[model samples]
Target: MRKILLALLVSTIGFSQNKPFAKGADVGWLPQMEATGYKFYDTDGKEKDCLQLLKDRGMNSIRLRVWVNPNNDKASGHCSKEETIIMALRAQKMGFRIMIDFHYSDSWADPAKQFKPKAWSNHSFPELLNDVYNHTFDVINALKVAGVTPEWVQIGNEIPGGMLWPDGSTNHWDQLGQLLNKGYDAVKAVDKNIKVIVHVDEGNNNAKFRTFFDNATRQKVRYDVIGLSYYPFWIKKDYTEVIADLEFNLNDMVKRYGKEVMIVEIGGEDDKVENTYQLLATAIKAVKNVPNNKGLGVFYWEPQGARSWSHYNLSAWQADGKPSPALDAFKE
Candidate 1:
């Protein structure tokens, strides 16, 4: 009883800040973006005004993707670590909590392709491991220097199988286990309080999730959050199918794995964009139990499309030349 009383006292003093999210509650939503669209640069570029735009829309957080080396690309612009730190600082000034996504690659690293950056391309296995550790430490420290502390940090991007491929690939859990530890330790080494997440793409595929998280746990690497990406188009036959699978997995992950579940990235494409709003609404509704009880909130993968609003991607909010059903889904 004394221990319980002391614990309550400690929490009362430490958690004096506002937390819309209940300790195990789910009523909170983390409205955010990949934030690559803001084009956070100072080369006399047209101000994108993304921070102000999000503020007006009631978003509480921003997720920024950090690349080892950035080059102009169709999918991701490859925002450099420095550029990302500056952008995160700007968002912090705007009062938005940050979720720093480390791609650990020079370009986009998803479930399909987890490419090793050119720098780590020729390094030996041991050398590559150290490289990842150093890179992780450096990025976190850089964020501290910029006065932008991240609330959540993803060690890798949508790591469906494994990252750094072949060597750090999911196909090989033994080596993958070591790599996971290296990244997790590096983050904890700097600040034990910061949340570390290992993200995977197959949120609906309970089997895949079980296999992935099960393997990671067996490997002995502890993580605070289980980040899952559930895009209707990418994961299943359609949005409905994905949502059904999501509901199943949400309960399964939390129950079976005993770790908090976070839907880090989720959205539909043009083919499914016709009823995208309704589809997303239904999905969000299906997971309403998360905010008040479980930690389940979905983020619209990348709301801002490429350079100039392009029609190819129904993923962007401006694809329709204005807010479309896809963009409207978030407001619900």
Candidate 2:
């Protein structure tokens, strides 16, 4: 019995060491797409569930973003806490590891804009901190109750400038750090094993990452993963040049911070399937090449979006409802 127990323990440790590489897609718009009568089809033209199709193409994880009180915007109601739970449960049932991205805003929260939610606009700094903590805790707790424990959780989405607007902007690192720490504490209080991420856009810009993380470090902001968004067309550089810069930056970040990293959001022109494929392949390879296997994986943002969502020109699906060849990059 002693020998058997020793063998079991060793096997368990070995299994834990071999963590699944997160080949994933941010299908946050999936619920909305389905509601709009969008149906995904396999290459064979047979109707299939979107998640299954992605799984068939080697995707092992799903990323969903949650908005706080999204009802303020008529077009942004699908990402509320309740809707996110429904979507997360579905992904879990399909055997996909989940990552929850908290926008902490009623609408989009990116470098260009980090507007405070309408309800929290007038909140005092301390009150706003509490709001952030409580909202994160509540959503995570609800997900736990639904039997969908996320493997990763982002405190805010693409928050290179900072979250919650002027109060938490880069200029006010103290407040930003406090808000981030509160969210981090809430996540750990719920599940210490879940890896927390601090995401930023501009994967190819090493200077930007260094600047953001330098301040974060100075302020002692706690986090586990460094998430980045890489878009080739947006960068507007030669493809090779972009890939080289991104790889260099990825390596630099891993070595500098001693933390795992992932391309949390990536997209390219939907019409340029071949170029997009090459871009993804290069980026994934760079990430996987990080020393000590500290690289987590790459996640395509809204790959399923197509003509239905005219705004997302970077979608990886063709007009015929078939996934574009660009998705083949995930197979690599």
> Measured by TM-score, how close is model 2 to the native structure?
0.95
What ranges in model 2 sit over 4 Å off? 1-15, 72-75
Instruction: Please provide, for model 2 over 118-217, each residue's C-alpha lDDT reduced to its tens digit, 9 standing for 90 to 100.
Output: 9999999999999999999999999999998999999999988999989999989999999999999999999999999999998999999999999999
TM-score of each: 0.82, 0.95
Residue 97 lDDT (model 2): 95
lDDT for model 1: 0.68
Weakest 10 consecutive residues of candidate 1 by summed lDDT: 22-31
CA lDDT scores, all candidates in order: 0.68, 0.90
By TM-score, who's the top model here?
2
Following a full C-alpha superposition, what root-mean-square deviation does model 1 have from the true structure? Answer: 6.0
